[model samples]
Target: MHRSSDTIGAIAAALAKAQGELLNPEKNVIATIRSPFPREESRTFRYASLASGLEIVRKSLGEHEIATVQTTAIDHATGQIQLTTLLAHASGEWISSDWPVCPITETANPHRMGAALTYARRYALFALVGIAGDDDLDAPDLLVEPSPTVQPPEDPHQNRPIPRKSNGSIHKPRQPKPVLSAEPSAVLRDQLVAEIKELNGADDLALWAHRRLPTKNTLTAEDARMVETAYQAAVGPLPGRLDDQVTPLLKTAQKRNKAHLRFVAEQPCLVCQRTPCDAHHVKFAEPRALGRKVSDEFTVPLCRDHHRQLHHHGNEIAWWGNVQIAPLEAAEKLWQETLAAPRPTFRSGVQHHPRPKADERGASSRDSG
Candidate 1:
């Protein structure tokens, strides 16, 4: 501890040594984090989870003689939750920073406010160290692993000082926060866009465009020609590559996934049993990038409104009427049940209508278009 009589040189030396050791990124203390709660629309953006942040401070900074403490207070003017972080040095000197928690509103429900404050705490501490995630160029965090309950710093703003036991540790149960997701950072988004553009060359792109143009069926020959001509006019002449003569078969994994989603959308909303649904891809297997998404086969069909709700407030436990179900796991189980059902065979008496009119059937209409 520093005394009023302590020499200035000793204090400076101690802080310099600690700062130099702490700033090195090469140390194993920092971690690369991929968020468990990525944006429902995309997974390209992520931030350090609270667990990861606490782990970093406890493990990384503690080793360097620094301890992080937080003081939570309400910004009365804005009525926003504020979390202030104090990075204390072993020498009894410290630096503190405070930021208002944006997601917590003045009129938010208590539960929501608690959750938002929890999220803000993690972010404030994580940022103080200048560490970053892969997507940080940023967004919102989880931990399934067991860990210690990180103690909060003494809240100086409170009327009374918080008491500590003789051992000098306090126990506090943290309310887990849900992510308030943001769009991908400009740098990461640009990198992804550049990667996609560089993925295919001019010739390949021209042929890909040509094949995508409607060349037959729901589309009249005249319509097909018009589309092809327009495509050429806009982008340029088609490449010398061969035309896609036969319609593509639904064998590729991508095709199979699309077909499964279509089939699921045909059914009633899995949550509310409502019609006209959107197929939401839930967690299954490992998470992948937006462009290399997991198949729609793992989706749960929900109405547009419910789908938005899930993206917003639906955690692992979703309340549908009197039932509490984990949407992803429930959807997986539903899919498993279908596998056990026997497929019915077609009888000779039933005639297959192979030739479908464009206006009557989607397949023909798609082809014609």
Candidate 2:
């Protein structure tokens, strides 16, 4: 260390000795960042904003005498924001540390760039000060816990088939394209039927698909194609597709309805009528499987805060039930109005509309591959 820095070091040591207990990172910082956008399908959450992280450090560090936190632009190209935490001692000496942090945003828009800077500053402070906070994006989705009554599968990977590598490319084995004949032969049909049976029963799933899609049951060629698609999608061909934004044919209908309901339901908090809302399905009509409330068409807008309130406090169950009753003319009117209004082109952080691609039968989807 420089001889000149010795004096500054001594001052910092003494200050830390006297006030170290006060800088509890846990007390100051929000450990778990509650995401504004939570993907139910993936069961993941987004990180907190830069402003939030910084405020914690600022508040915690202020207690140390004559302390100040400043963030300066360090690099424009790499989008690094340097944060400096400074403390000036009474002996005409000061101690400081500079933590340079990189931007997190992938895109380079001016607004987004600025936000990245703020995020960098916030993280830099956390790094330099040893603040503790859980990064929401770092964790994976929670898996379903095994039921005590049921015997767990011997191999966790038992049913998982070897993923296909493309033969077209060296990276993935090339899968033989299924013969696109008018319909498969009896043996092939039995095989496809067996595959579908292994999954969430073919009858219920097929029935669900028939109800959702414009297809006939059992006999129609279209129905057969859908069953095949559903089987292939579930088994091996489409790896990692179970977690896709667009559910495969057998799995897609309910999720599709939910997505459509959410997109069309956007407006304001139904209770307070404000933007930055959530689509809360009013289930007063009837409770369906997978916690679907009536149909997704019943989804109405509710601000995040109020939405939480409804879920947390169920004292108003009767009132909520009343909203679900048929002849919901008022709800229908609101739905029509939103549909009639111009569609919002942008929904910050969320890409792709609730509407699915045309080929996918209006099921919500994104670049799952």
Candidate 3:
């Protein structure tokens, strides 16, 4: 429960933070992020880009120093390229802006790299276009100035005193003018009146209105009428008084065995021994009269497919009762009955024992003679 609460709290906090960032434009700024593949040792190239006011640079460093190269800068507004030669300088090892890098021997601020790249790009452009007044170099075909910022006008209502015209003279006053409350529009008033009339005709609305207005306490006639009308609209005409007919059932099946029902769903099916199973009642008695109580004897587990079959054929109660019987005893009885039944028999032809051999007897007599 504590873990769940913590997770909810974290999610709520994140949503609130995101909403705050969106609503407050001054606090939000666009940023570009770049990082090198730390394990690779190839020659690194410097990259530069603009986003909001944030510029980003990324590069990898090897043992060899980078060489100076001539580069062309494109003018955004004029579609012209200015060429200039510039040296590449290493600014030491890079580190994460938001996290500390303990393993790196040298570390530089992440934000500084972006700033340096932006300045370098601007300087290269200016030099190529001969903006610094180099007489030897010819000016580029097209030159453009950097973009400018535009500021909005201040709001008159913000931190300003209200002006009032008195006796044909305008003057600022220390206190603000009293604000008069506006009346409801004619259309809204007409709509409310129509709803009130509709509600007055309904008995349920009258009861609800009475509850809202409270008969025991003092109430204006207009207020009572409004409440009565609202109640009538909310509840339609009924045979008995609103309170008498709206009584909750004493033994609602939905409430009595909620836990048992959940257990039935979670437990594996007895026949298939697989999840998840359906809970079946053992009797086809009136469902409403059974109430909400769940008992082991009354409930049986069946897989979804089997449960559907039982319901489809109106055999759910009968199947449940069969499962409730002692399954082992039934199986044992079935086995015993199978064994007791007579089976087909076969017999071999009869064999008789022979008397002493005549040859043996003759031999014995001759020996004696």
TM-score, cand. 3 = 0.17
- Candidate 1 lDDT over 1-369, as tens digits, reads 112323334434544554455432222233444543223333343444566556645766676677788887765433346678777767776666786664233334777676677767766665666555224342244423557898899878756555666899875547553322223233333332343344333334343443432222224334444444443344332232212221111212532345446645655565556668777765322222222444554666677756665555433222332123344454454454344434545578774434324453343212211
Question: In candidate 1, which residue ranges exceed 4 Å CA deviation?
Answer: 1-43, 102-108, 138-369
The best-first sequence of candidates by lDDT reads 1, 2, 3
lDDT of 3: 0.36
If scored against the real structure, what TM-score would every candidate get?
0.29, 0.29, 0.17
Tell me the TM-score of model 1: 0.29
lDDT of 2 by residue, 103-132 (tens): 322234577666655665655545545554
lDDT of 1: 0.48
Candidate with more favorable, higher lDDT: 1 or 2: 1
Residue 164 CA displacement from its true place in model 1, Å: 72
Please tell me which model should have the higher TM-score, number 1 or number 3: 1
Please give the RMSD to the true structure for each candidate, in Å: 25.7, 19.0, 34.9
Model 1: residue 58 alpha-carbon error in angstroms:
1.8
Query: Cα deviation in Å at residue 264, candidate 3?
Result: 2.1
